[model samples]
Target: MKIQKFGAGVFTIENFLSKKECDAYIHDSESRGYEVATINAISGPEINKEIRNNDRVIFDDTELANALFQRAKGFLPASLHGW
Candidate 1:
Protein backbone atom coordinates (compact mmCIF):
# COMPACT_ATOMS: atom_id res chain seq x y z
CA MET A 1 0.00 0.00 0.00
CA LYS A 2 1.09 3.59 -0.61
CA ILE A 3 0.05 6.92 0.79
CA GLN A 4 0.85 10.33 -0.66
CA LYS A 5 -0.19 13.94 -0.58
CA PHE A 6 -1.30 15.94 -3.62
CA GLY A 7 0.96 18.84 -4.62
CA ALA A 8 2.99 17.84 -1.59
CA GLY A 9 6.45 18.93 -2.66
CA VAL A 10 5.31 21.82 -4.84
CA PHE A 11 3.29 23.39 -2.07
CA THR A 12 6.30 23.64 0.18
CA ILE A 13 8.87 24.47 -2.48
CA GLU A 14 9.73 27.90 -3.80
CA ASN A 15 11.91 29.06 -6.63
CA PHE A 16 14.16 32.10 -6.58
CA LEU A 17 16.88 33.74 -8.58
CA SER A 18 20.14 35.55 -7.90
CA LYS A 19 19.95 39.32 -7.92
CA LYS A 20 22.69 39.82 -10.49
CA GLU A 21 20.99 37.92 -13.30
CA CYS A 22 17.63 39.31 -12.30
CA ASP A 23 18.60 42.90 -13.01
CA ALA A 24 20.83 42.08 -15.96
CA TYR A 25 18.02 40.96 -18.28
CA ILE A 26 16.00 44.01 -17.31
CA HIS A 27 18.69 46.50 -18.32
CA ASP A 28 19.21 44.68 -21.59
CA SER A 29 15.74 45.39 -22.99
CA GLU A 30 15.76 49.14 -22.50
CA SER A 31 16.36 49.99 -26.18
CA ARG A 32 15.02 47.09 -28.15
CA GLY A 33 13.78 49.14 -31.07
CA TYR A 34 10.26 49.62 -29.83
CA GLU A 35 8.03 52.30 -28.37
CA VAL A 36 9.15 51.87 -24.82
CA ALA A 37 7.86 53.79 -21.84
CA THR A 38 7.31 53.35 -18.14
CA ILE A 39 8.28 49.97 -16.72
CA ASN A 40 8.08 48.77 -13.16
CA ALA A 41 8.80 45.70 -11.06
CA ILE A 42 6.25 44.74 -8.48
CA SER A 43 4.69 41.87 -6.62
CA GLY A 44 1.03 41.40 -5.73
CA PRO A 45 0.86 44.37 -3.35
CA GLU A 46 4.46 43.63 -2.57
CA ILE A 47 5.92 46.50 -4.54
CA ASN A 48 8.24 48.45 -2.29
CA LYS A 49 9.45 51.52 -4.20
CA GLU A 50 8.17 53.41 -7.18
CA ILE A 51 9.63 52.10 -10.44
CA ARG A 52 8.03 54.49 -12.90
CA ASN A 53 11.50 55.66 -13.91
CA ASN A 54 12.36 52.16 -14.98
CA ASP A 55 11.63 51.00 -18.53
CA ARG A 56 12.12 47.28 -18.02
CA VAL A 57 10.51 45.20 -15.34
CA ILE A 58 12.87 42.55 -14.14
CA PHE A 59 11.70 39.87 -11.82
CA ASP A 60 13.26 36.89 -10.10
CA ASP A 61 10.88 34.59 -11.95
CA THR A 62 10.02 34.71 -15.65
CA GLU A 63 6.51 33.24 -15.45
CA LEU A 64 5.58 35.47 -12.53
CA ALA A 65 6.79 38.51 -14.38
CA ASN A 66 4.78 37.52 -17.44
CA ALA A 67 1.64 37.09 -15.38
CA LEU A 68 2.03 40.60 -14.05
CA PHE A 69 2.44 41.94 -17.56
CA GLN A 70 -0.67 40.15 -18.73
CA ARG A 71 -2.74 41.48 -15.84
CA ALA A 72 -1.51 44.98 -16.55
CA LYS A 73 -3.04 44.80 -20.03
CA GLY A 74 -6.15 46.47 -18.67
CA PHE A 75 -4.13 49.59 -17.93
CA LEU A 76 -1.69 49.36 -20.80
CA PRO A 77 -3.95 51.28 -23.17
CA ALA A 78 -3.26 54.42 -21.14
CA SER A 79 0.50 54.07 -21.50
CA LEU A 80 0.78 55.05 -17.83
CA HIS A 81 -0.19 53.71 -14.43
CA GLY A 82 -0.93 55.01 -10.93
CA TRP A 83 -4.49 56.01 -11.40
Candidate 2:
Protein backbone atom coordinates (compact mmCIF):
# COMPACT_ATOMS: atom_id res chain seq x y z
CA MET A 1 0.00 0.00 0.00
CA LYS A 2 1.13 3.52 -0.75
CA ILE A 3 0.26 6.38 1.57
CA GLN A 4 0.59 9.98 0.47
CA LYS A 5 0.02 13.02 2.59
CA PHE A 6 -2.08 15.42 0.56
CA GLY A 7 -2.29 18.00 3.35
CA ALA A 8 -2.67 18.25 7.08
CA GLY A 9 -5.09 15.58 8.28
CA VAL A 10 -5.58 14.59 4.64
CA PHE A 11 -4.13 11.51 2.98
CA THR A 12 -4.55 9.29 -0.06
CA ILE A 13 -4.02 5.58 0.26
CA GLU A 14 -3.34 3.68 -2.90
CA ASN A 15 -3.98 -0.03 -3.37
CA PHE A 16 -5.61 -0.25 0.02
CA LEU A 17 -7.57 -3.33 -1.02
CA SER A 18 -7.18 -5.82 -3.81
CA LYS A 19 -9.78 -6.07 -6.54
CA LYS A 20 -11.00 -9.44 -5.26
CA GLU A 21 -11.40 -8.14 -1.72
CA CYS A 22 -13.32 -5.14 -2.98
CA ASP A 23 -15.55 -7.35 -5.10
CA ALA A 24 -16.27 -9.55 -2.11
CA TYR A 25 -17.25 -6.55 0.01
CA ILE A 26 -19.57 -5.31 -2.74
CA HIS A 27 -21.23 -8.71 -2.98
CA ASP A 28 -21.66 -8.97 0.76
CA SER A 29 -23.20 -5.52 1.08
CA GLU A 30 -25.50 -6.10 -1.89
CA SER A 31 -26.71 -9.39 -0.45
CA ARG A 32 -27.56 -7.56 2.76
CA GLY A 33 -29.46 -4.85 0.79
CA TYR A 34 -29.57 -1.11 1.21
CA GLU A 35 -31.81 1.78 2.17
CA VAL A 36 -31.93 5.45 1.37
CA ALA A 37 -28.96 7.08 3.10
CA THR A 38 -29.64 9.53 5.88
CA ILE A 39 -27.75 12.30 7.60
CA ASN A 40 -27.69 13.45 11.21
CA ALA A 41 -29.86 16.51 11.47
CA ILE A 42 -30.27 18.92 14.36
CA SER A 43 -33.41 17.08 15.36
CA GLY A 44 -32.18 13.58 14.56
CA PRO A 45 -31.23 11.26 11.72
CA GLU A 46 -33.21 12.12 8.60
CA ILE A 47 -33.01 11.71 4.85
CA ASN A 48 -32.16 14.83 2.93
CA LYS A 49 -31.92 14.35 -0.80
CA GLU A 50 -30.45 17.81 -1.20
CA ILE A 51 -27.48 16.81 0.95
CA ARG A 52 -27.10 13.23 -0.14
CA ASN A 53 -28.97 11.12 -2.67
CA ASN A 54 -27.39 7.77 -2.07
CA ASP A 55 -28.19 4.38 -0.64
CA ARG A 56 -26.41 2.55 2.16
CA VAL A 57 -26.58 -0.65 4.12
CA ILE A 58 -26.35 -0.84 7.88
CA PHE A 59 -25.53 -4.40 8.85
CA ASP A 60 -23.75 -6.05 11.74
CA ASP A 61 -20.83 -8.15 10.54
CA THR A 62 -18.37 -7.88 13.38
CA GLU A 63 -15.84 -10.30 11.90
CA LEU A 64 -15.65 -8.50 8.59
CA ALA A 65 -15.54 -5.11 10.26
CA ASN A 66 -12.72 -6.18 12.57
CA ALA A 67 -10.76 -7.68 9.71
CA LEU A 68 -10.97 -4.47 7.74
CA PHE A 69 -10.06 -2.41 10.77
CA GLN A 70 -7.01 -4.52 11.47
CA ARG A 71 -5.85 -4.17 7.90
CA ALA A 72 -6.24 -0.39 8.13
CA LYS A 73 -4.75 -0.04 11.60
CA GLY A 74 -1.30 -0.71 10.17
CA PHE A 75 -1.61 2.39 8.03
CA LEU A 76 -3.10 4.68 10.63
CA PRO A 77 -1.48 6.61 13.41
CA ALA A 78 -1.45 4.94 16.79
CA SER A 79 -3.23 7.94 18.20
CA LEU A 80 -4.88 10.99 16.77
CA HIS A 81 -4.99 14.44 18.41
CA GLY A 82 -3.88 12.82 21.69
CA TRP A 83 -6.84 10.48 21.52
Candidate 3:
Protein backbone atom coordinates (compact mmCIF):
# COMPACT_ATOMS: atom_id res chain seq x y z
CA MET A 1 0.00 0.00 0.00
CA LYS A 2 1.30 3.42 -0.95
CA ILE A 3 0.93 6.23 1.58
CA GLN A 4 0.22 9.55 -0.11
CA LYS A 5 1.95 12.56 1.39
CA PHE A 6 0.88 16.10 0.66
CA GLY A 7 2.97 19.26 0.55
CA ALA A 8 0.96 20.74 3.44
CA GLY A 9 2.40 18.12 5.81
CA VAL A 10 -0.67 15.93 5.55
CA PHE A 11 -0.45 12.17 4.92
CA THR A 12 -3.21 9.76 4.03
CA ILE A 13 -3.42 6.02 3.53
CA GLU A 14 -6.09 5.22 0.99
CA ASN A 15 -8.59 2.49 1.82
CA PHE A 16 -7.38 2.49 5.40
CA LEU A 17 -10.60 0.97 6.70
CA SER A 18 -12.39 -1.89 5.00
CA LYS A 19 -16.13 -2.02 4.30
CA LYS A 20 -16.76 -4.37 7.23
CA GLU A 21 -14.77 -2.13 9.57
CA CYS A 22 -16.79 0.93 8.50
CA ASP A 23 -20.09 -0.90 9.02
CA ALA A 24 -19.00 -2.08 12.45
CA TYR A 25 -17.89 1.43 13.44
CA ILE A 26 -21.21 2.92 12.38
CA HIS A 27 -23.14 0.25 14.27
CA ASP A 28 -21.07 0.72 17.42
CA SER A 29 -21.38 4.51 17.31
CA GLU A 30 -25.15 4.36 16.81
CA SER A 31 -25.58 1.84 19.65
CA ARG A 32 -23.49 4.07 21.94
CA GLY A 33 -25.94 7.01 21.47
CA TYR A 34 -23.39 9.20 19.67
CA GLU A 35 -25.34 9.80 16.48
CA VAL A 36 -26.29 13.34 17.41
CA ALA A 37 -23.99 16.11 16.25
CA THR A 38 -23.30 19.39 18.06
CA ILE A 39 -23.11 22.92 16.72
CA ASN A 40 -20.06 25.00 17.53
CA ALA A 41 -20.28 28.72 18.10
CA ILE A 42 -18.24 31.56 19.52
CA SER A 43 -20.30 31.66 22.70
CA GLY A 44 -20.43 27.93 23.32
CA PRO A 45 -21.49 24.61 21.86
CA GLU A 46 -25.08 23.46 21.51
CA ILE A 47 -26.73 20.19 20.44
CA ASN A 48 -28.13 20.18 16.93
CA LYS A 49 -31.66 18.80 16.82
CA GLU A 50 -33.07 19.86 13.46
CA ILE A 51 -31.20 17.93 10.74
CA ARG A 52 -28.82 15.24 11.86
CA ASN A 53 -26.05 15.41 9.25
CA ASN A 54 -22.93 14.67 11.22
CA ASP A 55 -22.55 11.78 13.63
CA ARG A 56 -19.70 12.81 15.89
CA VAL A 57 -18.25 10.19 18.21
CA ILE A 58 -15.78 10.93 20.99
CA PHE A 59 -12.83 8.60 21.54
CA ASP A 60 -13.32 7.77 25.20
CA ASP A 61 -12.16 4.21 24.70
CA THR A 62 -8.47 4.16 25.60
CA GLU A 63 -7.68 0.83 23.99
CA LEU A 64 -9.34 1.77 20.71
CA ALA A 65 -7.65 5.16 20.72
CA ASN A 66 -4.22 3.65 21.39
CA ALA A 67 -4.68 1.03 18.71
CA LEU A 68 -5.70 3.59 16.10
CA PHE A 69 -2.87 5.87 17.10
CA GLN A 70 -0.33 3.08 16.76
CA ARG A 71 -1.67 2.24 13.32
CA ALA A 72 -1.33 5.82 12.04
CA LYS A 73 1.65 7.02 14.09
CA GLY A 74 4.21 6.06 11.47
CA PHE A 75 2.54 8.26 8.88
CA LEU A 76 2.39 11.30 11.17
CA PRO A 77 5.23 13.76 11.45
CA ALA A 78 7.54 13.55 14.47
CA SER A 79 6.88 17.21 15.39
CA LEU A 80 3.24 16.35 16.21
CA HIS A 81 4.13 13.62 18.66
CA GLY A 82 4.21 15.59 21.95
CA TRP A 83 1.36 17.97 21.28
Candidate 4:
Protein backbone atom coordinates (compact mmCIF):
# COMPACT_ATOMS: atom_id res chain seq x y z
CA MET A 1 0.00 0.00 0.00
CA LYS A 2 1.17 3.53 -0.72
CA ILE A 3 0.65 6.41 1.64
CA GLN A 4 -0.77 9.50 -0.04
CA LYS A 5 -0.89 12.89 1.56
CA PHE A 6 -4.18 14.64 1.04
CA GLY A 7 -3.42 17.94 2.77
CA ALA A 8 -2.25 19.35 6.04
CA GLY A 9 -3.08 16.87 8.80
CA VAL A 10 -4.78 14.67 6.27
CA PHE A 11 -3.40 11.44 4.84
CA THR A 12 -4.84 8.32 3.35
CA ILE A 13 -3.78 4.87 2.30
CA GLU A 14 -6.03 3.43 -0.33
CA ASN A 15 -6.71 -0.25 -0.03
CA PHE A 16 -4.51 -0.39 3.03
CA LEU A 17 -6.45 -3.36 4.29
CA SER A 18 -7.39 -6.41 2.29
CA LYS A 19 -10.85 -7.96 2.40
CA LYS A 20 -9.51 -10.90 4.38
CA GLU A 21 -7.97 -8.56 6.94
CA CYS A 22 -11.20 -6.66 7.33
CA ASP A 23 -13.19 -9.86 7.70
CA ALA A 24 -10.74 -11.13 10.28
CA TYR A 25 -10.98 -7.92 12.24
CA ILE A 26 -14.74 -8.09 12.23
CA HIS A 27 -14.78 -11.77 13.18
CA ASP A 28 -12.27 -11.31 15.96
CA SER A 29 -14.13 -8.30 17.32
CA GLU A 30 -17.49 -10.07 17.25
CA SER A 31 -16.12 -13.24 18.78
CA ARG A 32 -14.42 -11.35 21.58
CA GLY A 33 -17.26 -8.97 22.50
CA TYR A 34 -18.85 -5.63 21.55
CA GLU A 35 -20.57 -2.91 23.54
CA VAL A 36 -22.63 0.07 22.55
CA ALA A 37 -20.30 2.96 21.72
CA THR A 38 -22.76 5.75 22.37
CA ILE A 39 -21.89 8.36 24.95
CA ASN A 40 -24.05 10.76 26.90
CA ALA A 41 -24.05 14.54 26.46
CA ILE A 42 -22.12 14.90 29.67
CA SER A 43 -19.33 12.81 28.14
CA GLY A 44 -20.24 9.80 30.28
CA PRO A 45 -20.97 6.36 28.87
CA GLU A 46 -24.61 5.87 27.97
CA ILE A 47 -26.84 4.00 25.54
CA ASN A 48 -29.10 6.68 24.24
CA LYS A 49 -31.18 5.88 21.20
CA GLU A 50 -30.93 8.10 18.10
CA ILE A 51 -27.51 9.38 19.10
CA ARG A 52 -25.40 6.57 17.71
CA ASN A 53 -25.87 2.99 16.66
CA ASN A 54 -22.38 1.65 16.49
CA ASP A 55 -20.95 -1.14 18.58
CA ARG A 56 -17.51 -0.49 20.02
CA VAL A 57 -15.12 -3.39 20.11
CA ILE A 58 -12.56 -3.11 22.87
CA PHE A 59 -9.29 -4.73 21.98
CA ASP A 60 -8.12 -6.47 25.08
CA ASP A 61 -5.73 -8.42 22.87
CA THR A 62 -2.51 -6.44 22.75
CA GLU A 63 -1.06 -8.68 20.10
CA LEU A 64 -3.78 -7.82 17.65
CA ALA A 65 -3.63 -4.12 18.41
CA ASN A 66 0.14 -4.00 18.15
CA ALA A 67 0.15 -5.92 14.92
CA LEU A 68 -2.27 -3.47 13.33
CA PHE A 69 -0.34 -0.52 14.66
CA GLN A 70 2.94 -1.86 13.32
CA ARG A 71 1.44 -2.41 9.91
CA ALA A 72 0.16 1.15 9.72
CA LYS A 73 3.22 2.75 11.27
CA GLY A 74 5.14 2.69 8.03
CA PHE A 75 2.39 4.49 6.19
CA LEU A 76 1.48 7.00 8.87
CA PRO A 77 3.36 10.14 9.72
CA ALA A 78 4.91 10.22 13.17
CA SER A 79 3.71 13.76 13.76
CA LEU A 80 0.10 12.74 13.42
CA HIS A 81 0.42 10.09 16.12
CA GLY A 82 -0.05 10.43 19.92
CA TRP A 83 -1.76 13.76 19.60
Deviation (Å) of 12 in candidate 4: 3.6
Tell me the tens digit of each residue's lDDT in model 4 across 1-76.
8677877777778887899988988898789898878776787777876878887876577897798799888876
**Candidate 2 lDDT, tens digit per residue, 28-81?**
889989999999999999999999999999978899779889988888888888
Q: What lDDT does model 4 reach?
A: 0.79
Name the 10 consecutive residues with the lowest summed lDDT in model 1: 8-17
Candidate 1 per-residue lDDT over residues 1-83, each given as its tens digit: 12232552222112233467558655655544333244334533333335433233333678967875675444343532444
As for TM-score, the candidate ahead, 1 or 4, is 4
In model 1, pairs of residues that clash are none
Please identify model 2 stretches exceeding 4 Å from their true place: none
Q: Write the per-residue lDDT of candidate 3 for residues 1-79, one digit (tens) a residue.
A: 4588876667778777788988999898777776467788677877757744676777578998888789878777778
Top TM-score hit? 2
Determine which window of 10 residues in candidate 4 has minimal summed lDDT: 74-83
What total of clashing residue pairs does each candidate reach?
A: 0, 0, 0, 0
Score every model by TM-score.
0.22, 0.80, 0.63, 0.63
Number of clashing residue pairs, candidate 1: 0
Off by over 4 Å in 1: 1-59, 78-83
RMSD of 2: 1.7
> Candidate 1 at 82: error in angstroms?
20
Better of 2 and 3 by lDDT: 2
Global Cα RMSD, each model: 14.6, 1.7, 3.9, 3.2
Which stretch of 10 consecutive residues in model 2 shows the poorest summed lDDT? 6-15
